[model samples]
Target: MSHAGLFISFEGIDGSGKSTQARLLADHLRGLGHDVVLTREPGGSPGAEEIRALVLQGDPDRWSARTEILLFTAARRDHLERTIQPALEAGKIVICDRFADSTRMYQGLSRGDLRAMVDDLHRLMIGMEPDLTVLIDMDPTKGLSRALARQTVEERFEDFGEELQQAMRTGFLALADEFAERFVTIDGGRGIDEVAADVQQVVSTRLPS
Candidate 1:
């Protein structure tokens, strides 16, 4: 969170409707006359986008855990430098689809007990956290089914299957508790309109556009 701008991030399981909710919030904020910059992780800047393709498009096991962490850190550093920092400095609202939290869950939790490594890299390279983080919580089984319905070339992470996804759901929930200062949990099991309303309420109450 920066004093000059409102930085919001959305976190959830693969099919927990986080992406959709994040977009709707950005639109709603824009309608309220706020300058909003909607972006996604692993590819917000040009360099990060290049890293995103490399990290996501290949086989699931293409890179070892440590190497993958390095790549993600590189992307995040570029994102912060090229896209996020500038937006915040200009006093615009930045709504990111994901941030370093995804790295904690995906690379650290899923691969092994690499949480410290993730935090260390983030602290060293990209030290800022979102001003507000909306964690859309949902049942892992349901989320996985919804995720599988959509087919994409970037299915490498999804290839890890439901068990890991369940773990991820728990990990994210725990994170909300750990980082409660900037976290809000939304029940994404509900309808889109309801979820959007809840998300809007949370953001408006905190940021007011």
Candidate 2:
């Protein structure tokens, strides 16, 4: 779907610092006087946020892969209706920390080979892709370490262990290749400021003058 504003999403394996970069980029763009909306998947709008708690904060086996695709798609649908589409229609930059790509990895690839199902649901329910996607590439082991150190209730994904992280990193890089036109891969193994600087530079090129 096309819109007047830019829809940018950040994707990465666990602890790739995509969330931090998304926030930093939003702040940077807002400082430059662009109307910006910073949001996240599974929990952007109130309804989606409720779904987030259900999907993100439970046992690793709490939801089956098929069930998760449905939940995530439902949450994404609510988020799109309540937050994303409106912001873009108003010509605002919407920076989402995570989006369908993340689900494509976590639920679609992580548990089993359900990517086709995820894509089908996405096409049926959420027929949009970000104008740009910033992928923060990091070492799976290091990223998992950083993620586990956070100790948040949302660690169900991380709780799946480093193997899942490894698979996710590989899957994300493949996704980047699949969607090369809209995906910009950035090394996230550097300092926060360094990664943020690269992110800002990439995004600046895409934003309106």
User: What tens digits encode model 2's per-residue C-alpha lDDT throughout 87-118?
Assistant: 99999999999999999999899899999999
Q: Which digits, one per residue and each the tens of the lDDT, describe model 1 over residues 1-209?
A: 45588899999999999999999999999999999999998899999999999998768899888898999999999999889999999989999999999999999888889989999999999889999999999998999888878988887878889998999999999999999999999999999999999999999887743
Which pairs clash in the backbone of model 1? none
Residue 108 lDDT, candidate 1, scale 0-100: 88
- CA displacement after TM-score superposition, residue 20 of candidate 2 (Å): 0.6
Tell me the TM-score of each prediction against the true structure.
Answer: 0.97, 0.99
What's the residue-level lDDT of 117 in candidate 1?
Answer: 97
- The residue ranges of model 2 lying beyond 4 angstroms of the native Cα positions read none
Residues forming the 10-long window of minimal summed lDDT in candidate 1: 200-209
lDDT values for all models:
0.92, 0.94
lDDT of 1: 0.92
